[model samples]
Target chain A: MRLADLGERSGVPLATVKYYLREGLLPPGRRVNATQAEYDESHLRRLRLVRAMIQVGRIPVATVREVLAHVDDDSLGLTVRLGAALWALPHPAGEAPGAPAEAAGPSREAADDPHRAAADLLVDELLARLGWSAARELGALSPAHRALVATLATLHRLGYPLDADDLLPYARTMEQAAAHDLDRMEQLPTPREQTEYAVASAALFEPVLLNLRRLAQCEESNRRYGL
Target chain B: MRLADLGERSGVPLATVKYYLREGLLPPGRRVNATQAEYDESHLRRLRLVRAMIQVGRIPVATVREVLAHVDDDSLGLTVRLGAALWALPHPAGEAPGAPAEAAGPSREAADDPHRAAADLLVDELLARLGWSAARELGALSPAHRALVATLATLHRLGYPLDADDLLPYARTMEQAAAHDLDRMEQLPTPREQTEYAVASAALFEPVLLNLRRLAQCEESNRRYGL
Candidate 1:
């Protein structure tokens, strides 16, 4: 298929498809002549995946490129690919205090950024206490750690006063959910299929979890407020 | 305190605070003279919340205004206030196939958007079958509905072939998590505290849920690859 047909068939705009090509998000089609190139089914598949990550998953282009590179690299093992995807994706407050939503209050800078250190320590203690060894195994500053630390910092600044005990249950709940997801993915027959399933779970079905939480929140609010 | 002091105490930049003021995210400070105005602790708190929503939560300014308006409107009940926060947040893929992530292939336009309608019906049936009555109460096109439908469409386009049965476990998991969150929030004594907690959950801690999922994915991948 020509570039135009790739755009038409994929339902992605021609300009957007060209942009992806320029960004190296979508690999260039086979060079048919001086001015024209041809795309194939593989390009179509890649295009859909790129669109899914950028458009649906709301991942930035750089991150998308990193993640796709990992997904396409057969030299890396499945776990490495998975880690690559996890690392490439954005976290809630990984940037922390500078970002407003998760920023620590004035108290954060008090006494040599004690709040930051305490938040970090608290997360370590919480994980150790909860026995989430897999997460701990990733080291102290992994994406999960960054995310957890940021949440703890934000909670403290917000006056919630959460401790390790408060977080253990949530961690356990997520562990169980992840276990369930992995159990399902394990049944797939091929590594490629499994990787695709993992990517799909991360990219597409993630909203199911978040949306369900919102639904549950709505339900609870209704129960409490009788709305 | 004056606006400068308000900005200082909140640790938000004076210019950004002023922006929030002009944007109606922060209520006007009390006028003290022709050129001066007095602010109070409430203003500081509101500023922090506004910052949290915009910076950490990544909510649009317009949505923040709508949410804050609900939070401040005493005429509204607790349920209404809760609904207000939920309503103001963005859905994962509320725009659907129109967005690239879930664009249906050649089959999408064959029968005048049947894929969309089918996806909607599948979500509705899934909720009903799973007995997620609380979500159902929000009607057919709630944020949760929009999110779920978009996810369904994306999964279909991605060739995942999911149905309600496949999603039941995930919905159940989130329901359990929500129940836990609400149970904790209910421990707070006043509606103000509860509302603050609710907003924090929706904004900051929500990342905890997402990040934990990533952690779980990494762990599962490690296990699969024997890493």
Candidate 2:
């Protein structure tokens, strides 16, 4: 396959495929001659993954580069590699006062703040209730832990009350979803395939989970209000 | 309370409060005399909601206005009002080629497309598995349904295989989360409180659901790979 066929087969435009090649998102095909190079099945496969991340996941190219690099490094353990990809993917956090959404999450400098302490504690309690020691073992050190706490603190500041118990149901369900995800990914043939699956699934299926919740809420509202 | 006092109580800056007033996000305080007006608890409450949507939800001002109007219309039934709010909130959908994330959802112009048909039938199967006729009854017309279908379609186009059974567990759990949300809102005293709570909770707690999944994925990955 040539670059043109790679693009056509993958349903990506030729120019965009060229752009990915230039950005090193897709490695150059084997040099066939002065003005032409031949792509193989591997190039097509890589191009497909890159397109999924950029197009469906809306991931920035630099982050995609980091994710691809993490997946490429086989010296790391499976969990570590997968964790790197998850970390590289976007997760929302609380915003600073009047700050833009991009600059979210409360500062660590506010460790003495009661609101921060309370929110952080809520995450621990929720994790405990779900019996998730992997999350609890890391305590406030985990990025996801910090991010959840910051989001809770922001909710508190806005006069919306939240408790660990309130999140228990959602937490349990999210854990269930994660189990389903990992179980499915385990059947994949290779580490790279599993990591790619994890990264893409996290980014893409998030919307499925989110919109399903919304759609269900709609049904619930209709039931309650006689719509 | 006066304008300054209103801003103080809401934790919204005085400048931002004034800007909200100018932007029609907040109605003007009762006129006390020239250059003076009195604000009450209601004004304080509205300001809080406005700040939550802007700072936490990252919702645009125009969409907030639409949502607020939906809530404010006393003539509309409870479900209608709530549905309007849900519609106004952001939901991820499939992106068009070369399109930005903002312009998502497959265009209706392609009604005959097989990918669209398969993705949509997948949603119907998912709804049937959950016994959610409310979602099924609405069909292709519902934004959330369409959004989910479009999302699944995008996944298929990217070479990701998904089945209705794969989403059944997730949909069941998301329905549970919605039950939790609506039950909590049912306890609020007034329609205004309930509506405001629904809007705020939907925007703010979305992060909790999202990050919790990431954290749970971390735990699951660790369990499988032996972190």
Candidate 3:
């Protein structure tokens, strides 16, 4: 299809599509002549994925690129690719990616960052208590791990005083739901397909998880406070 | 306590505390004399909440003001206060707060936003099917409602084809979790305490929900694909 048709069909503006191509977010279309290019169905699908990641997921372009790299890396196992996809999402505030590992650097300034050490220890204890094997693949400093630690710190900072044990039930609940997510993805025939599903789920479905929790909170509140 | 002591105890910098005061996110300290003000324990607590909301919750200054206002409003019921807190959190892209109701504006241009109308209808159908009374208090145009609709719409746009029926299990699981949250909060002594807990829970603990889900997903992947 022509670039115009690709934009029309994908519902993305031609200029934005061109910009994505320039940014390496979209694969280059086949050069048709000196002035034009042709996009295929795969391009349309990729464009849609890009839009989903950027527009709906609110992911930065750099993070989106990293996630796409993981999706494209055939050497990685399904679970490993899924792990990378998980880490590639936006980090919570006060937590940069690999924050704990960064604190291990030799710079004099690194030693002053106690929050990273505290968070790492907290998560280690929680994982040990939960008897979960995920830490083996996630590494101690993966963004997801740091995010959990940062959350606890925030709660404590607000005087909420959440114990690591308090997170167990919620973890178990998510594990049950995630089992369903993986069960469906595992049925796909190819690693590429599995990675695609993993990426899409990680990027696009976060709002589903969050909004569902909010809605449920509302229901619980209504029952408690209402006559 | 003095303002300096409040800043020290809260761990928020004096400059930032002053900024919150100027922004009306924190109440002014009682005047002690010329060129000085006396802040008490309440100021210290409010400063902590402000830091949590801004740093951990990533809430913008304006929304923080609105949320704090709701917390301080004695005339509002607990349910209303919670609903407002829910609305004040970051919303998913394509889901502006009160989006469903925006289409009802008198301007002829308003009715063309089909995504909003479609999302509203989808949520309405889902709420009816779930037999949840939350919609009454949440209002059809509430932020949580818009977020849910926007998520479903994003899925559709990305070619995932999620029906409102498919959201049932997620809603049920979240209800189970939220019951725990509300059960804990209801034990607090007064309406003010309840509202504070609700706001803090809504604003700060989102990372707990998101990161737990991510960690659990990793475990699910390990179980399915690991040796």
Candidate No. with top TM-score: 2
- Candidate scoring better on lDDT of 1 and 2: 2
Q: Alpha-carbon error at B169 in model 2, in Å?
A: 1.0
How many clashing pairs in candidate 3?
A: 0
Residue-level lDDT of model 2, residues A1-227, one tens digit each, is: 88788989888889999899899888788898999999997787788788888877778899899888887778889999998878877666855555323224434544766666677677777888888988888755566777788888777777775987788888888889999999999888899889988887887787888889889899888777877
Model 1 root-mean-square deviation: 5.1
- Local lDDT at B20 for model 1: 92
Q: Answer with 2 or 3, whichever has the higher DockQ.
A: 2
Q: Candidate 2 chain B TM?
A: 0.91
Estimate the TM-score of every prediction. 0.81, 0.92, 0.85
Clash numbers, per candidate: 2, 1, 0
True contacts kept of each: 0.52, 0.79, 0.60
Candidate 1 residues lying further than 4 Å off, grouped into runs, are A1-44, A60-62, A94-111, A158-161, B1-9, B14-43, B94-111
| Clash pairs, model 3 backbone | none
Say which candidate scores most in lDDT: 2
Could you tell me how far off, in angstroms, the CA of residue B65 lies in candidate 2 after the best superposition?
Answer: 0.7
Give the poorly placed runs of model 3, Cα more than 4 Å off.
Answer: A28-40, A94-118, A187-189, B28-39, B94-117, B136-138
lDDT of 3 by residue, B1-227 (tens): 88888888876778988888998988888898998998887777777777877776667899888888888888888888777766666765432232233322322332565544555566777788888876644554566665666666556655666666556767777878898788778788877677777777777676777777778788777877882
Instruction: Give chain B TM-scores in order.
Output: 0.81, 0.91, 0.83
Give a tens-digit lDDT track for model 3, residues A24-93: 9888889989998889987887888888878766788998888888877888888888787667777554
How close to the true structure is residue A40 of candidate 2, measured as C-alpha lDDT? 92
Which residue pairs collide, candidate 2? Answer: A94-A105
Q: Go through the candidates in order and give each one's C-alpha lDDT.
A: 0.71, 0.80, 0.71
